[model samples]
Each structure stands twice: as structure tokens, then as C-alpha cells.
Target chain A: MPKRYVSIWFRYLATDLHSLCQPQLKSIPFVLRSPSHGRMLITSSNAIAESKGVCQGMVLADARAIIPELQVLDDRPDLKEKLLTKLAEWCICFSPIVAIDLPDGLLLDASGCTHLWGGDQNYVNDIGKKLHARGYDAKVVIADTIGVAWGTARFNRKYQVVSTNDHLSILQTLPPEALRLENETVERLHKLGLHKIQQIIKAPRASLRRRFGQDIITKLNRAIGTEIETIVPIMPVEPYQERLPCIEPIATRVGIEIVLEELLKTLCGRLTNEQLGLRTSILKCYRIDGKIEQVDIVTSRPSHNIKHLFQLFELKLQNIDPGLGIELFLLEAPRVEDHLPSQEKMWEGSVGLEDVRLAELLDRLGNKIGTQSIHRYLPDEHYWPERSVKLANSLQEKPIISWRVDEPRPVQLLHTPEPIEVTAPIPDYPPMLFIYKGKEHRIVHADGPERIEQEWWLQQGQHRDYYRVEDEEGNRYWLFRLGHYHDKSYKWFLHGFFA
Target chain B: MVVSKADIFKGLQTDLLRLQGLKSVNNCELNNFLGPIASAFPNHSFPLGVIHELISHRQEEVAATSGFVTVLLSMIMGASGTSIWISASRNVFPIALKAFGVDPDRFIFIDLKKEKDVVWAMDEALKCGAVSAVVGEIGEIDFKTSRRLQLGVEHSGVTGFIVRKASRNIGTIASVSRWKISSLPSEKSDRLPGIGFPKWKVELSKIRNGKPGTWDVKWFDGKFFPTHVPIDTLVASDQWHKKKTG
Candidate 1:
């Protein structure tokens, strides 16, 4: 199958955008000007200004002399690039591969996309009509190669769909500049009486290469389909992606759910055959109004279960707003991992973390609330209470070392210790009484000054003298004193509560 | 003839308890772990596949209740079964669970910011039959939500525990039993100078169709040891013995 490409050239991109924002500027002749070589030069002009004497590359003062009532607006440095990028993203509704042909044009790989709109002619016409309705004077052309489409969209009077077999016939009539050569090279060809491409096409290859360098031959070969050309798309197509194009715009929740179910079934089917599972997926809904609404879901582990994946996506479907209605739905899985199918067992028993149902339940919960809130901890080799446990990276991660149960640890450890007022016998003895949160507790049974020194390699802090003390009411509290009892500024804090 | 009449009455009572979705204690292997507390539950068995409400008003009580619940979880999950703990603000240290004979890695901890999410996560976890138990820490729960959780566990056979923290009003809920646990001063049997194993005053405030009593229990060597039988439970057991032998 031959590949087809489309190029859209915005003739008055800057002026047209200005006119769209300020509707009153539509009737008047205006030119956008920018500072160049210490002088204001006209960068772009509206159709009305071009119909008059004002044109691009003219000095602002000279343009004003021609049309005294011409309105001049400041031209932003990156406005053209920004507008082209936005237009290219919008063109994704037409084709998946859209690239910005810098300055004023967009290139699209319309290989198999044109059949959706009937044919190449109707596809180009639809794009041109939609762009015209948006207040942009866009010239669109479709051809067998990007070079021919790009040159024809800019220089041709009307949109044309050049057939695959008529590449040289089309290039022969156009001027030598149609090959996309440098301006200096085009001028040299013209000085040599080679104004038409037909004359250049018939010239000897060695002489042409000697005169114009190898760039012309490479460009010519690319244009005639003798060499291949690749485009860098704005959004790279995902390896595991499914697309659903709606014949009629859909707006209801049920309609969206049906589309999501179809996409999931297709994507999951492919993953199952390859023994792969999706970890994260994104669903993009292209609205008829040219705005894309997207929702994404992440799984705790790799999964290819369609029902489970759909349930996770269903939790986040409310975030999508179908203004006007959506015409296209695309699901792309960005992260995937190898998944080995679990063998069926004869009897039901404990499966632990390897259970697929548990992963699905966690995925549903994580999608509803957040993934960060769900955690499984493994023991770390540290004495500090906060540093004793570390978050497990995944469900399959195992504890390298067993938990330290030799020493006494509190049932509930406070994130930050609360200060307490204590009365003690001094010299590292446990407190006799302590007041915390405006309440007084008389200690009856007291334990040790288990000194835990701070690891200096990780941080610097005073050693804590911990005591497991029971109050008169039988409520046990873990209290700690900072530094030594003889220190001038020694203080006590209630660190935790023991069961 | 008199023995047959008593046996028939006991059989009818067991059937009635079974009608109310309480499995008989004869079928459960966990009866020995709870000791005499198992007799306080319907059918003289520790209830499974039902919601249990644990109330705590202070930080100390919360810790005690957490310890008691972790002991039950260790028994329920056994060695390889998994569990989930959902809380708004988690204060339970994971490492401490090892002291209760539970592998910390086997328990998934979900720390949410809202009580609503905690309850929702607990409900989801309960519906998942792969886990043995689900524990949730929240401020309050009403009858409707608790009933939904009860319905979820009835089918999945997963036990649920909701720890109500700092709740001022104990509202009506659909839980099968309600408990309140507070720390008790450890007894130094060896005349040691330091504190001993954790002791808790376990109070069964409510049970659907069984006796509610308080008992003193202590945890050491990775098991619950009944320190002593309170007078109330002793009398109840005496009556139960009389009914069986008289």
C-alpha cells in the first residue's frame, strides 16, 4: 500500500488569529509587524491588506505610505509556533501522526485515515472547510509524498489530491522551487534558465549535484517516492492502542461506557495473546468541538482482565465532560509488563498476595481514592521507629530481614512526640508523674531507660531514654527524655501508647 | 427422658442461632484461641463472616483495642492468608504487629484522608474473598453503612472489624457484637522491677444473642492468656455448667 500525506498551510495565520479574538479587526486591513535589523518589518498581513498594496517583508513605514489607514499590530516571537502546534494537535482527529512543519505549515501522515472520510479528496475538503469556519485561511493538499504536498499546499491556488502515479507529471509543470530547495539554490537554477521543474528534472545528475550540492538530489528523490521519509509525531502512537470512531456524536454516559467496554475488550484480548498486562492506561475522548477529554487509571500489578480494567476506568469516567459530544475514543496502554497465567487449582485455599482478585480489588480502591494511600510495609534494619519500616515497592516484594521483636515497641507510635511535664527522681530514673494534653497521670509501674542512640551516619540527634510506664488508671504510655538528666535543657516527651 | 428433653432444647437453640447466620462453635477451629470469651458469643463460638464494632474514646484505649484486634487477625489469617487495614490516620506501628505473631508484610495498610473513603475501602476489601479479614479505623459509622458491610461479609466469609476512635455517641449499628478494651496494669508475677506483658480489660458490651461480660486477658509469647475469670463470667459459666449437668 502506498502512503499518503497531507500538508496544511496557514496563509495569514497571525492576522487571522488576531481577527478571531477581536472580531472588529475582520473588516479593516491590518499587518502584523516585528522589529528586524533595527527596523519594524511587516511579518504577516490579512487578506484585505494583501489585496491592497501592503505585503510581508515590507518596511512598516513603507506599508503605511501605501495604505495610510492600515492597522499595525505587534507580532509575538513564538505566536506562530504555538498556533501551529495547537492546530497540529487538533488535526489528530483526522490522522494519528501530525507534525509541525515549522513557521506556517502542518504535516500529517494520512496513509490509512482518508478512507474514513470516503476518499482523499473529501478528506482534504473536510479539513479545509473546518479550518475556514474557524477563521483560518488554510490551504490543504494531499499527495503521495510530504514534499509534494507541502509545496503544493503553499503554491497551488486550490486544494488538490495528487494521484500516486502522476508524481513527475505534477512536478514538471510546477516551478523549480516546488522541490523545496534553498532560496539561493532556487535562484541559481533560475539564473541558469531552468525556471520549470521539467527542465531541472531532465538535467544531468552529476552536473546538478556539482552545481547545487547533494541536497537537491535528496529532496528530489524524496518528493518522487524513490526514497523514504519519516515524520516525528506530536503524540507518539502507543504500541498497545485501540481506536473507536463513532459514526454519530455520543454524549450520554451509557454511550461512553459502551465505547470503553469495546476498547477494553479489544486491548485486553491482544494483551492476553501476548501474555502481557497493562499497568497504566489512558483513555482520550475527542469531542466534536475539537477538544480532547481524557481519563487514566493505574493498576497495582499488571492485569489483562477486561472486567477489572473496565471497573477501574468506570470509577474515573465521571471526570470526562462530553461538551457538544465526542466523536472518537482512543485507549492507549503506556506501561505494560509480562504476566504469566496462574494455573487453576483443584481446591480453594490461601493464595496470599499472589491472588488476582486481591489485586483487582486494590486497583479499584486505588483508582477511586489514590494509589499513594495504599501501602504495604517491609522491615528496614534501623532502630529508629520511623525508619524501622519501609514501604514495599510492589505486592511481590518480600521482607529481606525479619522484624525486630526482641525489644519492646509501642502498639501506636505517634508521628511526632508530644511534650509532657514530668516530675522524676533525676539521674535517669523514670518519671513518677506526667501531665499531657492538660491531663495528669500518676505513674505507678515504670520500666527502663532503654537508651537508643541516633545513627550519626544518617543524622545527628540526642539519644533518647525511653521508659514504658503504667499510670494509676492502667493506661500505659511510652515516654522518652531527650539528652541526659543532668543536661541544662533536658526535657521529656510522650512518644507513644502501649497496648 | 429428662436428658432427651434438655438435648432437644439445646438442639433447637443451635438451629435458631444458625438461622440468624451464626455458625455453631463445633465447626470452628478458633474456639480454643479465645478461651472462655468464645462462650459469650452465640453458639459458643467466635463469630466469623460478620462485622465487629470496637469502641475507643482515648488514645490509650485505641492502642489496646488495636492490640486485641491484631491478635484476632493473626489467628484468622493464619500463616499465609492476607488482610487489609484501612485508616484515616494510621498510628499503629507495623513492626509491633510482629509481636502479635502477624507478618507485617501480609497486611496491606491503606491510609486515607477521609472517613468516608476508609469505610468504602473496608467494604471493598471485605467483598474480596481472597483476604481473611479487613480492619478499618474511623471516627463513626451509622447503621446503614454497617449493614452494608455485614451484607458484604455474609457472602465473602471475610470478618470485618471497625475501630471507632474518639466517638462521643455510640449509635445503633448492625454489627454482630460490640467490644470495648482498655489497658490493664501488667502484673509482675516474678517480682521483677520492670513492666510485664501487655494486659487488657476486655469488655464485651453487646452481643446479638449471647451473654456480654468483662474479663482480664494478657498477651505474651504470641498468644492470649486469660489472667483470671471475673466474678460475672464465673457465675455465668457456673449456670452454664448447671444447665448441662443438672
Candidate 2:
């Protein structure tokens, strides 16, 4: 099969961008200038400035002399590359493979994509019209090869599609510069009176190589379809992505659900075949009003179950507005992991975190109430009560060490200890009575003075003397004293309550 | 040979209990854990796969209730299964579950910001057959929401416990039982200097087709031990301590 390519040449890219940002700049003659070799040079000019004899590469002073009232704007060094890359991304609706052809153009590998828009002619015309609508003056051309398409879009008067059989005939009529050769090589050819590409192609290959080197011949061969060219698409194609274009805009909730189920079925089927699962996925709805609404879902573990994935997405379907109806739907799985098929168990009741149903339930819960709310704790080797436990990263994580059960820890621990007024016999003794929140509790039974020094490696602070006390009402409290008992500024805090 | 009046009355009471949807004691695993408390239940066995409400008005009572519920979860989950604990603001120390013979890693904690989200997560967890139990700490729950949770557990067979903390209103709910647990002074053996093992006054305030009773129980050796003593003896001890201190 013959390869087809489309080249989009932005004739006035920089000036058009400036005009689009400021509408008043559209009717005036302006030029974008940047410093080069300590002198300001015109990098690009609007059509009005070019018509008035102010062209790129001219000194700013010279251009001003030609048109005194020319509007001068500072040009960013990477403006052209940024603009072309953005345009290439926007051109993804036409073809999935679009690459930036440096300086002022984009090249799209439109081999199998033109048929979607009816034909190559309509495809090229559609790109030009859309770009014009966006206030960019672009000349789009489609041909059998990239070189031919690029040359015709920039140098030719008419932007037309060239048939596969007429590649050599079209090259024969174009100037030698259309072959995308160095300026010196084109100048040498012009001095030798070889004006058209026909003369260069008829010349002996060895002699042309000796005189002009191999660059011209290589570029010439690429244009005539004897050599192959590949494009690096701006957006890498996702391995697990499905697209559904609607003939009529869909607005109903049922329609969206149908689309989601269809996409999920196809995606999960592919994943199941390869023994893989998706951990995260995003659904993008392209509305008719030129806005995109997106919702994403994440699973606790890798999953390829169609029903489970559909249910996870269903919880978020209400977030999508579908304003003015949606015209296209795209589902992409950006993160996937290798998932082995679960073996069939002999017993019917499989109760554990490893159960697939459990993971599905957790995924639904996590999605509904932010994923941060769900946590599993594992013991950490720290003496401080607050540092005794840490959150588990994954469901399958096991604790490395057993919990410290020898000490009598409180069942309920406060995030921060509350200050309490204690009346005690000083010098390492439990409080006889403590007042908390305007209530007084008389300690009938007390244990105490279990001094725990601060972990100097982690922080610097006063050591705590803890005590377990039982009040008159049989309520047990864990209290702590900061600093030494002899210190004049000792303070008491109620940390926790025992069961 | 005719049946006596007492035997006839006993048979009629059993029939009435059975008609109230309470099954007889058939599972021996729960018989020893509840001990005398099991007799207060209609079937003389602790019910499984149903919602139980635990009410607490004080912060200390909440701790005692949490400990009691955790012990029940440990028994229900056994050694391999997992459970979920949902609350709006969680304060239960995860390591404390290990003291009750439960592996702390086997439970998942969900701390949400709204009561509605807590109830929703509890319902979802109850409907999941993979989990053995779900514990939710919520402030209030209406009859409709409790019925929905009961329905969820009916199919999945996952037990549920709702710990109501600082609840202002005590409305009727559709749970199988309502319990109130408060801390009780532990018995000191021979004038021990330190506090003893956690003791709680377990009260069954409401039970469908069952007796309502209170018992003093202590947790030691990873199980419940009934420490039933008369209230008069406790008051008498209190007076003696006051006299000595005075």
C-alpha cells in the first residue's frame, strides 16, 4: 500500500498569533524582532508588512526605514516550536499521528486516516478551513510522500493532492529548491543553469554527488517515493484506548451508560486475552459545543472484570454534564499492570482480602468517598504512641513485626493530648485528683511514674512520666507529666482512655 | 402420664421465642465466649449476621464499647477473614485490637468527614460477602437506615455493629439488639499496686424476644470472664475506702 502524508504550512504563524491575541494588530503592519549578534533582526512579519517590503532577516532599523509606523513586538526564542507543537496536538482529531515539522509546519501520517473524512481532497480542505477559522493562515497539501507534500505546500501556488503515479511528473515541474536542499546547493544549481528538478533528476548520480554531495540526492529520492519516512507522533498512542464517534449527538444518561459498557467490554476483553489489568482509566466525552468533560476511576488492585469496572465508572457518571450532547467518546487506560488469572478454589466461601469481590467493593467505596479516607495500619517499631502504627501502602502488605502487646495501651487515643489540672504529691507520684473540662475526678487507684524518655534521634523534647489512673466512676485515664517532677513548671496532660 | 403446668409454660415460651425469628442455640462456638450472657439472648446463643447497636454517652464509655465490639469482631472473623471499621472521625488505636486477640492488619479503617458517607460505606461493607464483619461509629441512625443495613447483611451474612457516640436522641431502631457498655472497677487481688485488667459493665438494654440484663465482665487471657457481684458489696467497699481515707 502507498503511504500518504499531509503537510500544513503556517504562512504567517507568529504574526497571526500576535493578531489573534490583540485584534487591533490584525489591520496594521507589524514585525516580530529578536536580538541576534547584538542587533535587532526581524524574525517574522505580517502580510501587510511583507507587502510593504519589510521581510524577515532584515535589520529592524532597515525595516523601520521602509515602513516607519511598523508595530514592533518582541519575539520569544521558542515561539515557533511551541506554536507548531500546540497546533499538532489540536490536529489529532484528523489523524492520530501528527508531528511538528520544525520552524512553521506540521506533518501528519494520513495514510489510513483520509477515508474517515470521505477522501484526501476533503481531508486537506477540512484542515485548511478549520485552521483559517482559528485565525491561522495554513496551506494544507496531501500527497503520496512526505517530501512531495511538504514541498508543494510551501512552494507551489495551488495546494492540491498529487496522485501516486504522478510523483516524478510533479517533481519535474517544481524548482530545484522544492527538493528541500541546502541554500548553497540550490544557489549552485541556479548558477549552473539547472533551474528545474527535471534537470537535477536527469543528471548523472555520481557527478551530482561529487559536485553537490549526497544530501540533494537523498532528499530527491524521498520525494519520489523510492525511500520510506516515519513520523514520531506528538501524542504517543495508548495501547489500551478505544474511540467511539457518534453519528448523532447523545444527550441521555442511558446513552452514556451504553457507550461506557461497550467501551469497557472491548477494553476488558483485550486485557483478559493478554492476562493484564488496568489500575486507572479515564473517560473523555467530546461535547458538541467544543468542550470536553472527563471522569477518571482508580482501582485498589489491577482489574479486568467488565461488570466491576463498569460499576466503578457508573458511580462517577453523574459528574459528567453532557452539555449540548456529546459527539465522541474516548476511554483510555493510562496505567496497567500484569494480572494473573485467579485459580478456582474448591471451597465456595472465600473470605479474605485476596478475594476479587472484596477488591471490587473497596474500589467502589474508595471512589465514592475520596481514596484517602480508606486506610490499613501496620505496626511500626516506635515507643511513642502516635508513632506506633503506620499506614499500609497496599492491601497485600503484611506486617513485619507483631504489635507491642506487653504494655497496656489505651483502646482510644487522642490525636493531641488535652491539658488537665492535677494535684499530686510531687517527685514521681501519680496525681491524686485531676480536673478535665471543668469536671473533677478523684483517683482511687493509681499506677505510675513509668518514665519514657524522648527519642532524641527523632526530636528534642521533655521526657514524659506516664500513669494509669482509675477515677471514682471506674473510668480509667492515661495521664502524662511533662518535665521533671522537681521542675517548677511541670504540666499534666490527659492522653488517652483505657477500655 | 400428664405434663405439669410448669413444663407446659416452658414449652409455650420456647414457641413464642421461635416465632419471633430467634433461632435456638445450635452453634457451640459462641456459647463459651458469651458464657452467662448467652442465656439472656432468646436462643441462648449470640446472633450472627445481624446488626447490633452499642450506645455510649461519655468518652470513656465509648472506649469500653469499642473494646467490647472489637472482641466480638475477633471472634466472628476468626483468624483469616478481614473486617472494616468506618467512622467520621476515628480515635480507636489500631494496636489495641491486638490486645483483644485480633491481628491489627486484618481490619481496614475508613475515616470520613460526613455521617452520610459513614453510613454509605457501612452499607457497602455489609453487602460484601468477603468481609466477616463491619463496625461503624456514627452519632445517629434512623429506623429506615438501620433497616437498610439489616437488609444488606441478610444476604451477605456479614455481621455489623453500630457504635453510637454522643447520641442525643434514643429512637427505636430495627437492630436485633441494643447494648450499653461502661467501664467497671477491676478487682484488686491482695492489694495490688497497679490497675488490673479492663473490666466493663455489659448491659443488654434491649433485645428482641430476649431478657434484658446487666453483668460485670473482665477481659483477661484474651477472653471474657464474668465477674458477677452484688451492687451492695460494691457500695459497702466504697464506704470502707471513704472511712479509711477520712
Candidate 3:
């Protein structure tokens, strides 16, 4: 039972970039160049350019002289590396272990992943198809070992799949460079009249190690099944959880609170030292009667304040019942963030914006009303009413763009613009009367249609013609015509209410 | 500073009032509630460290009740300390409170889904010594719940306000004072713009062994002005208008 490893080589990365970013250059010959000692050298070339006598390491002037219509681009190895890393991350969907091979390759330890996609053939085929759909021409090979997979992906023309029996036969045809060796090592092997891996297969091991040193034999052993390969995985984030065990079951709520306060004291110390704050925490009270009661609290921002955290916990404590007694308590911080220390002390210790009192208020409010419901909005640079306001991430995040106070915005804006029936004269005039939610309001005072065109690049939709109108009862409303008056899809909508 | 023969009894009365939690402002504030609203009470001032209940029997009257409470809350809250406002619905806009010259951030607004939690949270907030004041917008509060909150405020020396909607049972609860507030049409103005200064007809429905009467008050700028318009005068003015037309 041999393990299966999948290897993907971005053989034509430069051309694939051209196809992904600028699809118009897909059929043309593309070449990437880098400036070397004041002279441009070709870093990579597409199949079309290679077929037309263009090669990497060639002088740009000479390559251009051979194919005058070749598209030359600056070498973007950073972009290529980022693409490879992203592709490796994407491969985690198929296998839990995926490692990046720098500059243009990825290796997925597809030990158990192949059977999930039917078989080893389909597993490699599905990945290759997905990459191709995303404008990448990938060479995928699934073999018994990583070295065999790498050799097959680069050297084999059609059959890049290699099993245990076929791996040796495949290695016989591929060059020594297919084993991923240094240029000097491959050159020395070539000078010894051994260009293919099969030529060195029957060589004496002791003489090979003594003459060429250990590197060549090591490479040989790695290519064969003699040496083992391992991959390092991306580490997952560890949850911040602390557990406390009691000697005896405690029944009093005050007893449980005392334990909680002690636990929080220790946790806050660690969090502050690490400059981290908990956004959500859960206090699990395991009672001796086999009952588990948990109270969770969320903060508006990342907070590690012990007093504020205790007050928020105190609000939800009534929901917790001690019952017979409490045996154990566990406090878990599910969401943590890097929190920069706030300005708690103002001038001469005067209360400032980030006061402890304010934090307690926000935390207490966040517990009663959901944290999601508490929102502080700032103006955004958008003419669209829906996109005009953006929510602030924290209380201290000041708005760079000022609110457009010149235009009177409604005090209460509906989460969504509601459709309403309107009765008005001809095109684009303010509605004389409107019916919203089956209630009719006769408009008395009206303003003009302040037409706002749609941002077509962001979304293709109708332009809104907004009108501020006051009803007979002196209630003001913000109304808009969904699309252009000439368009057949035009409709009326009530957007918000004025104070 | 001398203790006269008659001044001894007057000193004894002042001391009695002070013992019943009557705190007098050092300076005269004719513009605020300390001038007129305070004198309308049995202690010759609004009693401190007690839960005050305000009833608004209609949807429109809730505004007047909140507006009237905002005036008292600003003074009781002082320039320091945080306030806990436990409400079931987020009907009172924070911006509207700002119009009353109050910083909305100074208040902790607890929006509970259940009415019982509002009372419980308010009671807990009242008991917390650090909190300066607590406001609970609840529906029906029984004597048991009211007495508990009353005891909490008494122990903590904090003030409490229970704002009930129109449909409350208003039977009897252990409260310092109970008032029914209704909004009145503001006076027509030629200077100020937007909505006029909030005017309310405050009726003292119940006060614990205290004077119960009605008063007309209006909030303008940052002060409360007592308008001298009683129920009899209003009816007399209507009769005079009919006679003049006839």
C-alpha cells in the first residue's frame, strides 16, 4: 500500500497570467523579461513563443529579432508565488495536507484524497480541470512518491501518471534534471555520459558516493522509493480556553461568581500581555446534578477589561441556575483579536471617550440587544442612498469623509427601500399622493426630483429620482423612482421617514 | 446663625426634611425643575433616592413622558456617573435625547425582549451603587416588583424612573410619585425653526401621602418653563371665545 501524492506545475505561468488578467493576449505569444546587469533577459516564454524560436535566458534583443510580434512583460515572480500559495490553500479542500513548491509548483499529500474523488486518475483530472477553468494551464501528476510526481509532471509528454512499477520505467526516459538537482550536479552527471536517471541506476553505491560526494546519491535515493518525504502543514489557530476544577460542589451563585472573577483575572493578565482581546466569551457552569448552564456575552469591540466583562456577565447571571451545586467552570474565548491599548487616562485623569464607564455600557447594551444590532454609521462617498452610509468597525474609528449635511437625509432609513404605489402627473414629477403599506398619504408640500445616476461599474441597475415630500398630516417621507422614467421597469418606492 | 426662641422649631423642621432624603440645591436655579417642579411636592422638592412612576396612556403621550423624564434625568445624572436605561423597545431615538442636551453615550440602553427582564435589569441596575440612575420602560409592574425596586434604590441611594405605556393597570405600587403626562400642541413660533419646544400637561395622579395636582410645563432651549394654564382657565377661555363670537 503505497501513498499517493499529487504534484502541479505551473509550466506556462506568464502566459497563464496574460490569459487570466488580459484575455485578449491568450492566443498571442507572450514572454516575461527581467533586467539583468542593465540588459533585459527573458525569464519565461509561452508555448507559441517557444515554438517560434524564443527561449528563456535569451537576450531580449535577440528574442525580439527572432519573433518581432512577441509580447514582452516584466517578470512578476511575486505574483506567481502568490498564485502558487493560493492554489495550495485551495487544494486543502481535497486533502488536509498541502505544501507549496516555490516559484511554480504545489504538492498535495493525496494519500486519502484520491478515493474521495473516485480514484487517483479522477482526482488528478478533477484538479487539473478546475485549474484550467480558472485560466491556468497546469500539468498534474499523481504518483507513489513526490519525486516521481515531480519528474512525471515536468518530463512526461502525455502519460504523467506513474505507479510503483511504471515509475522506474518512466525515470529511465526522463533526464537527470527531472529529479530537481543543481545545475552543476546535472552538468557533472551529463559530462560523465549519464544524462538519464536510468544510466546511473546500476552504478556501485560506494563508488558513486565517494566520487560525486553524498548529494548525488541523496538525490538518487530521493527520486527512488528508498528515501522518505514529509510535508509541513499550515497551523490552525488555538482557542483561548481556561478550565477550573473545584474541590467540592458549590451551590451558591456568589460562589460561582467568585470563581468566575478569579478565572477572568488570570485570563485578562495573559490577554493583556499578549496585546489580545476577546470579542466573544462563554462561561460554562457544569453542575453536580449533571446540568450544564452556559452564558455567553459579546462585546462591541475587542475588550479585556475585567470590570466591564464582569458587569456584562452579571446581566446574564440570572439565567444560570446553580441547581444542586456546581462542579466545574470553564471560560472560553472563541474570538480573539490584536487590540491596541486604548486611551483610558485623559488630561489629568479626566474622563475621555474610551472611559471604563463607556465600555461597561457598550458591553451591557451589547448583551441585552444583540451586538449586531448596535451600529454606528459614518458617511461613505456614494450618491446611492443605500451605500451612502458605512458602519464603523469600532467606536474610535473616526470618519475621514464628512457627512453631507447640506442635503437633508431622513432621520429613520428603512433597512430596505419598500415599494409603494404612487399617483402623479407625467414623467418624473413628485408624487401628488402615495400609498404605503395600504395607507394613503396626500402630499401637500413637494420638492423637485433630485436624480442620482447609478454606478454602472459596481452594479447595473436603475437610477433613483428622489423626492422629499410632506403629507397632509405634516409627516415627511423620502420617496424615489426606481429607474429612469422612460424605462419600462420604472417603479415607485418609499425610502425613509423624517423626524 | 443664632438660635432664636421660634427658630428652634424651624430648625427642627428643616432637620426633619433633611432626614427624609431632601437635598436642597445651594444656588437658586429658576430655569430648571428645582424651582417650580420641586415646590409641587410634599417635601417642597422632588424626593431623592426613590422610584418615580410616570404613566402615558396613549401612544403620543409617551414622547411627553420621555421628554419630561429627560429633564429630571439630566439633573439627577449630574455631570458624572453612568445611567442604565433598560427598555423593551428602541422607540426613543438616541438623537432625540441629544436634543434634550443629554449625551446618549452616558446611558447604557438595555433592550430586553421580555418585559420581566426590563424590570429585573432595572432593579439590578438600581441596586448597583456605582450607577447614578436607572430607567425602565415596562408595562405592568406589580406591588412585589415595585417594592423590590424601591428597596433596591433605598439601599443604594440611587434614583429610578419607571415609564409605563398607556395600557398599564396603575392600581398601586410603592413609588415616591406617579404622574400622567400628555403632549400639548406647541405655541406657534415666528423665530425658531423645525419642531417647537416640547410642551406637556403633567397630572400628578398619585404621590405617597403627598400633594397631587396638575401643572403645565414646556421645555425650551435647555430650561423648563412653567406655563400658568390650569383646567378651569382653559374651559373659561373657551367660554369667553364663544361669547365673543355670539
Q: Put down candidate 1 lDDT per residue, A303-372, tens digits, no spaces.
A: 9999899999998999999999999999999999998888888876755998888889989998898889
TM of each candidate vs. truth: 0.68, 0.68, 0.53
- After superposing all C-alphas onto the true structure, candidate 2 shows an RMSD in angstroms of 9.9
Q: Report the lDDT tens digits of candidate 2 across residue range B1-246.
A: 256888898899899866654546365666677666878876577887889999999999999998999888888888789999999988999988899889999999999999999999999999999999999998989999999999898888888999998987889888999999999877766545578778889999998877999988877655576776533344358664696688
Which pairs of residues have clashing backbones in candidate 1? Answer: none
Candidates ranked by TM-score, best first?
2, 1, 3
Model 1 chain B — which ten-residue stretch has the worst lDDT? B229-238
lDDT of 2 by residue, A1-499 (tens): 6689999999899999999999999999999999999999999999999999999999999999989999999999899998888888889899988999988999999989988999988988899999999999999989998888988888887658887777778878888888888899999999999998889889998999999998987988888878887888897444799999999999999999999999998999999998999999999999999999999999988899999999999999999999889999999999999999988888868788777788899899999998898999999998888888999998889999988887888899999999999999767878899999999999988887778888899989998889999998889999999998776878899999999
Better of 1 and 2 by DockQ: 2
Candidate 3 lDDT, A1-499, residue by residue in tens: 5788888898887668777788777788889999999999999888888889898899999998999898998886687777777777777887888888877888888887778889878888899999898878899999888888898898887775687788788877889888788888789989999978888878899988887778778777877878987877654344688889999988887897898899899888889999999999999999998889999998867889898888889888888988888889999999999988976544433233345555556567668756664555556788877777666676566667655655655544566788999998889678889998788988766666888888888889778888977666545667899877776788999876543
Alpha-carbon DockQ of candidate 1: 0.57
TM-score of chain B in each prediction: 0.88, 0.84, 0.80
Candidate 2 yields a Cα-based lDDT of 0.89
> After superposition, which runs of candidate 1 have C-alpha atoms over 4 Å from their true positions?
A1-238, B25-29, B229-246
Interface RMSD of each: 0.9, 0.9, 5.8
Candidate 1 accuracy as lDDT? 0.89
Q: DockQ of every model listed? A: 0.57, 0.60, 0.10
Clash pairs for candidate 2? none
Pairs that collide, model 3: B57-B166
Q: Poorest 10 consecutive residues of model 2 chain A by lDDT?
A: A230-239
